[model samples]
Target: MSSAFLPGFFLGFSLILAIGAQNAFVLRQGLRRQHVFWTCLTCALSDAVLIAVGVAGFGHLAMLAPWLDLAMRLGGAAFLICYGGLALRNAWRGGAALHAGGGDGSTLLATLLSVLTFTWLNPHVYLDTVVLIGSISAQYSDRLAFGLGAVCASFTFFFGLGYGARLLAPFFGRPRAWQVLDGLIGLTMWAIAAKLLVM
Candidate 1:
């Protein structure tokens, strides 16, 4: 169990470290420095919820079903194709042009909606955090430690992206940096989706 913890956390983090819509959104929020806490909080809490659900709901299925991986890969690929297209379009049209009306109320609402968009609409997020990570944990047959590791990893992601971003502020502070980052994320999503589909 103790050994499973490190492997589980590393597994979860490795899958999640890739570029995707959720990471794009979180990076945007971190760079904008607007409602950073709310955005990161929503992301972390949402992942925890989904991780729990996947562990509880699909725990048995992960071990029993062989086609499950195939279905998930295809589903994730389809979703990623769609999401990547939208993200690329957004990058071309400017997805980072957020201005929170210069009021506390507007900031809160905007932040909430932004996080909701990331939480609900991002397919990569669902696939990686909900499906892949959960499935991996379920493979252990004893996910009590793996589940906790996954939870810890989820929080670690938010903190790493939010707080650690301060170090990159000088570089990412530019609009061009956002464009490049968003564009790269979109491209990476497509490439990975294609890889999964082919495999």
Candidate 2:
């Protein structure tokens, strides 16, 4: 189990380093400096829960209920499409210039709900954190250590990303920068949704 720790940490980084919908949302929230701590914590904890489930050998649940994949795919695609459209609209409007100590005026509940939706509703998250991680952990004698390492990686990455975004505060002061960011995020979301549909 101890030997698997490093492998798990690196694997976790490899899997989550991609700029997916969830990551995009986190980046956006981080850049906005809105609910950074809670956002990062929620993402980390969500990954931890899924990792634990995977390490516990619950990956077979997907096999036991194949329909679950299709259901999640459809639901996820729908939500992504809607969210992507909203983002694109925001981009087109060209507002949302960043101000010091100011936020987008969203409530904490709304922010959490958005992050949770981005994390839990996305089928790819389950694929990466549960199925893939679970299957890989099975190869090791110390699955618990491997899972813990992956969990730690998750916590580290989320907090680092959420806080590290502040470094770009100077750049985001321009409204055009926010527009470009929103445009990219919208396109990314739509692309993921399209992939989900095709899958």
Best by lDDT: 2
- Please give, for residues 16-122, the per-residue lDDT of candidate 2 as tens digits: 99998888888888888899999999999999999999999998788888899999999999999999998898888986444523578999999999999999999
TM-score of 1: 0.66
Regions of candidate 2 where Cα sits further than 4 Å from its true position: 96-101
Q: After superposition, how far is residue 175 of candidate 2 from its true place, in Å?
A: 0.3
TM-score (C-alpha, index-matched) for candidate 2: 0.96
Q: Write the per-residue lDDT of candidate 1 for residues 1-199, one digit (tens) a residue.
A: 5777887788777876866656766776666566778878888888888777676656455457777677767766776677678667756875345222111243777767756765665455566666777777767766767767887887898878976766777776565665676688789778878887777
Error of 2 at 116 (Å): 0.7
Misplaced by over 4 Å in model 1 are: 59-106, 173-175, 182-199
Clashing residue pairs, backbone N/CA/C < 3 A, model 1: none
Q: What is the lDDT of every predicted structure here?
A: 0.69, 0.89
Q: Which one wins on TM-score?
A: 2
